[model samples]
Target: MNITHRVSLLCAALPLLSGCALVVNAAPASTATAAPVFEQWRETQHRGGDDLMTAGLGLEGLRASVAPVFSSPALPTADEARRRAIWSSWRGIADLTPGGGFGDRYGSVQSAPGREFSAYARIPGARHPHRVLVQIPDNFDPARRCLVATASSGSRGIYGAIPVAGSWGLAHGCAVAFTDKGAGSDYYDLDAKSGFQADGTPATHGALAFVPEAGTAAHGVAFKHAHSGDNPEADWGRHLVQAVQFGLQALDRAYPQSAPFTSANTRTLGVGVSNGGGAVLRAAEIEGDWFDAMVAGEPNVSIAGAPPLYDFVTQAALLMPCALLAIDDLPQPPVQAQARPLWTQQCAALKANGLVQGDDTDAQAQSARQQLANAGLSDGALRAGAFSTGFDLWRAIAVTYASAYGGFAAGQHPCAYTFSAVGADGKPGAATPEARASWWSEASGIPPGSGVVLVDGNAAHVADDPLRGLRCLHALGTGDSAEAKRVRAGIAKAAANKPRAGLPIVVIHGIDDGLVPSSMTSDRYVPQARAAGAQIAYWRVTNAQHFDSLLAFPDYRKRYVPLLPYMFAAMDQVWAHLEDPTRGLPQDALIETTPRADAPLQPAQLSIPVVSSR
Candidate 1:
């Protein structure tokens, strides 16, 4: 529909703000050229017969009827405010320690006796230390077989690893601690910032974490809302590296008790979704010594490529906003072909506006032409190829988050928190007009790391290369650009040396995903890992989204008897892997159960709602 018509329809559907008072005049005799005939209701006379007009009730009386529920309290302490702010913002799995401990020291285990907590630690430049949670079961016997089952988090919860953690303790009978790897709200505290700087804004603390306030434990720092000013390298690559390291650390701390596998000698596995899938690859590469098997579901590893994040952005930029509002509106092949230019325009827009940031601008897109030429493309073809792969993920952000329950629509605008520049007022600034001039503007680029600039992107997404460039310019000036490049080069060098693997890794990805493109994982990532000789086991969930595969099947509980050997056997595989170092992958099983009669299956619908206002 046209904008005017749609707006009018929307306005008509909405309830009016308030009723307006109506004024009427009494019937009067007028000249033919004057006013038309008018009719009015009779007025009652109060003292005599009964002629009186009842006035409409005023808002004054209505105002006194309702009472406020919350009362303003005294100003909170800096510490209290920080805690409450953190707590209120907390989503997903909170603290997932093995046998909970109070504070300070890694105290003796009181609950999960032999279990150990593996922490994914991230200490960005000048920021406070924040870690993702990973736990391992006690491995009293070193030779037991094990399986690393990596899990993705639910759409509204922390990383699905928490379920792995809980199940390991109860049903699985395994030593496992899932990762709260993403800087999103699930498991980490992205807001765990260092004190404020002279500008009064929270200093470069940790990068962005994920969002949603559903759970208790804080995962990694919510990088989605993080400022590039503080963290020059805000790319997911660095976070992935950190995730690998954190998984290793958790294994190291748990040692013989939880993880019996010798880092230098034993096998390991990996797994996860979108962010988790990215981490799964990194874990296999960066911690190759620890991961022997791995799997990824709808991973968004390469922003520039045909990953879910890439496709989502591509579709959003080109297609109309309401196109994907309903499932039936999914774009067909012809529509997808039309969106290609929109994605290209988005990249051009980012570059023209210098929206790309940080020091790593020279990595992929920075030298796309030269790289393409080296890879055997002619200048014109190279340029075309470069344009084809540029990463402009802004559309992806809007597409992934515009719905309810997603953090962007929720109070914690994770994407805006990370991308938009922050003003002196502590409020994040809006995107430049130039950036927003086109409906297909590129979103913010990933941040750089100590040595690495951007993490994942392609030549087509040229603008993502400089996501942190403006921040760097604002903070360090033009001279820092070269320095930033050098730093990224160094980081790449370092990351190359520390290839992921060497830890227990398990990946679970669905074959059919509507949001995330499953082909990316099954085709690109898994094969790449195998080519690299990554010690990872992958489980392909036949049909599901990036989120649904991680949930425990309720039907499994209803139909099967409790404590079945197969159930225990499945649990044992997970437990053994968490504790010991033996090569094996979890058996992929379709959750068995009966659907309720009240809620009959709808083939046209993906029963689980992806977006929600509540």
Candidate 2:
């Protein structure tokens, strides 16, 4: 497992280049050699009926309402878990359907039969092991060696970025490397005193992906990101580096004669979305040019100057529901507007609590909107809060990240929040047989996904609302308590080191991304990068937002375009740049995309520019 075995130095000129000069295999580029403690490794071949990218489900199966069934409900096979995970991941991440240019135009479902090697590898200090999977396409060309390393978006499991990153890499005959980045669907069942074994089946002990501390007072269920007590975000960059190292090592092992495929000769690109995107950007800063280029789409990157995700998310969690009322005629209102009754009560609660001014819901709502606007929430971002408010995503995010930043043990979250399988009364309890069985396949690593839910202990009466939790979470960062200090310290560690000025980065963001707004994210990061003389390309897409899957809803489908089309375009252009140094980064452009307005998608709706290969 030592990464040092494959020392290579084919590119002698790299040592002379001013900006692109890197550790040209004189030594291992990362501390990955010291870690990646693999517990179990499994290799499988995919051909004909099943394949690497789709897991044999293809596009039609991906869109089906129900997931692939486990042969035995109680004891599902590892292959079943893999297929269902891929299916759920695709549904969670991609904006498929002809209306979004998914089926007929882009986001093709061609199968790539390949060999897959996956394992649970523990980082040097992390308690829970992260999942890493590498896919070597059957048609892989060793002479034209190419590798794409990707991270899971949000807290999604292993195949989270498969739709966008995996598909593109496989189609181009490149090896695809994936890492859950210290967070995945490796749930630990607290009540059963059990956790997931290597292949997603339950086990009482022995080399499990996660287990709560022996004496911790966890209630129902647990997952790594919230309970690992490692503040895994701090080491996200290392995770990406480890995945890349693992991939290269796996490739060398697979084709021994093809031998040492180091960064010196192989072209490696890193790409991802949301947290995955952030991981790639963070890796570019820390690792010694392991990647030749990177593309980050709607990434939730945190740095010294930009406010942390918890800071803004907590704010929106408190005010967004009430504020959403003031915005009139949102495209996706009906699905969320059912919460109007609760929103009115929330507005009244805010006024009584002195959080906002005015007696009536209208005035209170407007005041709440203004307050969020002051917190760097763009008009689109404020409007976009409707989805979060409806799903209560902000509340869940605030609690989950607070636990991470504080490095709390399992079930030790502030605001009395806990991860669990909730009963009908919204109380944490033991999981049902079915919930536990399918969790590895169905759950996103974040709670409120699949069977697991985020329970607010303070608000037993209001299961749908988490006002008390939001209040505590909002005040968490600034308070002088020991927990707050711990959170602050961890935040410092998690802040990404400013990328080297010469590193090539292409950042693609939607103008209306409410989850991680550009005003607070890309707008802040890009200028700092450019000021430092970084070779960065910025693409701003109109009528696009962070979550493409939301487009399946009738209203959302009409107003927004998927970001994947442009993400692919940027990848193509960046690949060209990497192929020939003369092809410079794409000029910063504001793409005016056409929304899917109750009609089949035309390539014209995407408005992809002719990326000249001059």
Q: Candidate 2: global Cα-lDDT?
A: 0.79
Residue 581 in candidate 2, Cα distance off native in Å? 3.0
- The per-prediction tally of clashing pairs is 115, 0
* TM-score of model 2 vs. true structure: 0.93
Candidate 1, residues 441-488, lDDT tens digits: the string is: 111113221111222223334455433322222222112454334333
Question: When superposed on Cα atoms, how far off is each prediction in RMSD?
Answer: 25.6, 6.0
Candidate 2 runs further than 4 Å off: 1-3, 6-37, 214-216, 333-337, 424-427, 460-466
Predictions in order: lDDT: 0.30, 0.79
Off by over 4 Å in 1: 1-120, 123-128, 134-160, 165-182, 186-225, 228-269, 303-315, 318-507, 531-542, 549-614
Alpha-carbon TM-score of each model against the true structure: 0.40, 0.93
Worst 10 residues of 1 by lDDT: 49-58
Candidate of highest TM-score: 2
- Choose the strongest candidate by lDDT: 2
